[model samples]
Target: MATCAAPSESDAPGHPDRSRDDRWAASGAQLRALVDAFRSEPVTPARTLQFEHDVQIVVRELGRQVVPFRYNQVEPAAAVDQPRHARFEHETYTRVHAKTRQNVWTVFGQLVVRRIGDRPSQAGEPMLFPRAHRLGLVHGASPALAARACQLLAAAGANQQQILARLRADHGVGWGVKKWRPVSRAVSDEMGVYRHDAQVDQLRTWLAAAGASTGRHKPVVCVGRDGITLRLRMKRGSLYEVASTSTVRVYDRRGTRLGTVYLAYAPEPGRPAMRGALTAVIRDVLTRWEGPVPRWCDVTDTGDNETGYDDRVLRRMTHPRTGAALAWVRVVDYYHASERVWALANMLFGDNARAVGWAKTMLTWLLLPGGVNRVLHSAAAFRAARTLTRVQKKEYDRAYAYLRNRMSHIDYATYRRVGVPLGSGGTEAACKTVFIQRLKLRGMRWAKDGAQTILNLRVVFLSGIWDVVYGRVLAARPQPIMGGHVAAEPNELEIAA
Candidate 1:
């Protein structure tokens, strides 16, 4: 007993160093225990309840234990009372740790201030600087936009202010307001609901429109050598004249100029409006003509409303087969025929002479078999042909109900071999691009003068409006009042946070 046999390896002092064999055996035993715990049957509800009750009984029985150790040079009474003092010291420690916590760690910061209700309750205490409230009114972006901006800012090594400024300049402040906020870890929890609702509404409107517009209509092909007809309204205050015009240029299969028909009114004494009306009609008809044809009509009416001018002038040109139609080659049907042809040539090609040569070549090609019809329609057959679909027939006979003629003289199969646009959409698309892109915007309300200037400049710019737009805007300060309200002013205060 006095010698105590040198301690066995298992009873060695608690040193960190361990033998390989002992470590291996210990790890194997631990793994076995872990596997057994995982595979064991689950505790039943009654067993769980009983176990919880056992834990409660054990904790209650342990209670609080205190020991006295006033070994310092103190009075006898103080030494005896040390255990009572120790109990009070622990009570204060427990109160501070469990019940009397002053600062609660939160999103904004360790919460330094909180206002409880009069009765010391949760009521009336606003969650100060809630993520939702702060993300909207105070910030320049919705939470998601702000978060994206924050990410970009971080990558760019820029501050929140700089990112916000860039966003404002690019998209406008009003557009992105609600996204300004300090960078937050939990941004996903702060997204605005309104943005998603707006997107859903837009999809609904699109689906409704798609569902409603589903009827098939025959395409109207106007047989005209010049002009695609378009409708317009001319208005001065209360009185507005709804009208159409034909001041359009027609192009052939190769995008070559056919003619320019200026819709002009019949001249009359003291009837300016009526004259303008007929000219407007001519313009409209020309604008709407769908394809190339020989029988394009230009409207003309006598000034006096007392009698309507005979529509025969228009009808004769519209019905080329009626013998009254004037051949374009005839000099009598033209104005400054040589000059007009020369200009047309210039439009078709850079060199007028080359264009003329090309035109002659096209004329020879038009007489081939593909250009001529294989079957001749009798009067009866002509009448029956009128019942055919409008889109199927290239031309409809104005004189006879069924005697339809083809619109384009060129063979479409051959034309396809060459690059040719089926519709003259190039010029129309260009016009819309020039007009709508420059002038139209959401919620745009235009006044006469402002619209006219912008439109003129837009067309000018589109037609090559750059020089005029720059020169005019530079000539004077762009008017404060444009389209409607004053043009928005640049913000003086810096936007970057």
Candidate 2:
């Protein structure tokens, strides 16, 4: 067996390269011992866990050993264009430390990166490490670890405290909010670059699948949207704001939903961002469909926000190739329609059993052919029989108007027969699951940026496109210059050290 008699660096807070070779040898020894011990011992739960822990320790050490070799490959000597003495370059920078030490958090453990770094002469400028950027080491964590952190933080009901605890216990990574928050946010920002393209690709794939699906009816694409209330941090003038979410799904001719893609945005006065994005996504998929035009529809509740978006965006959309207006079938959520019925019933019967029976009959009537008109007629009969107080009369009129205004869109009977979804249940659930489920936990109030980061990640994740989107985003950024990190977002600047 290969032996490790070299001194250990375990006592030091940061591992130095002088003893990294020794640690690499020790890690190999540890791995061999671990396997041998596990094989010699009888299988047991405790023994298995011990083996796993031991493996993690040795593997982490091995990962740390990789940092130097990876940077060594980037050293200028191998380059035909640059002189061997020129280390890592950023713009015109050639003066760099032979070995610049950096501490980075990894899934395995904290790995210290000894890389070639350039020091900009400008005052107040941070040191730049080209190798770190190539390896996607930014915001104090490597890409692998950052992806894990983002996923855990974006998970429903996930908080920094819970994620930190998990990281400490399982991955041996001890990161506090100071480190974790920035890393998670940085990854979320990175995702913004490729998330839309990934979503569009996935949507096209689903639409193609639907077009090819064989059944009695043509394939259908249904779009739904809704909103939920969010609690903002105290600094914001209004402590509460409305957040919106949209879901687009492909339905086979059999009326089975094939797949769904979700998009969301933080609270905006009119949700213009979300609406524009939703419009583009739908248009892209529709234009890409090589088969017959699918039955496209907007299925949502009749909230002003929801209907206004439909009227302004969906109704006005046109085919990219031909410029012909794209018409969308309208559908008022059946559940929301039913709720309005109960509102009127309660106003008439004052929560009596008669109201319950009457609401049930009206909903049942709503499923038949020409049901909306029938329900309106039945409502008129009830109003004629009762002597309502002014308050009851006023509230009843409001409830009645809710149904009346959406009467044209509430064609539940034809929609059901043709396999069109009459309910916006998916979008309603997204309002809760995408936004409220994660951000509305007790004592949680968010700054717009923090909440938006989570929503951006959550939308892609819940849409079943996490790997596709995240993998591209986390992959190394295109080689911009010889060294240094990718340029920061427009407003934010980063001087990588």
Best by lDDT: 2
**Largest TM-score belongs to which candidate?**
2
Q: How does model 2 score by TM-score?
A: 0.85
- Judge candidate 2 against the unseen true structure and give its global Cα lDDT, from 0 to 1: 0.75
TM-score of each: 0.22, 0.85
Q: Alpha-carbon error at 451 in model 1, in Å?
A: 3.0
- Model 1, position 215, has a per-residue lDDT of 32
The C-alpha stretches of model 1 lying farther than 4 A from their native spots are: 1-423, 435-447, 468-497
lDDT of candidate 1 over 165-232, digit per residue (tens):
65543323322223233322222112211212222232233323323333331111121111111222
Off by over 4 Å in 2: 1-48, 66-90, 119-126, 236-238, 480-497
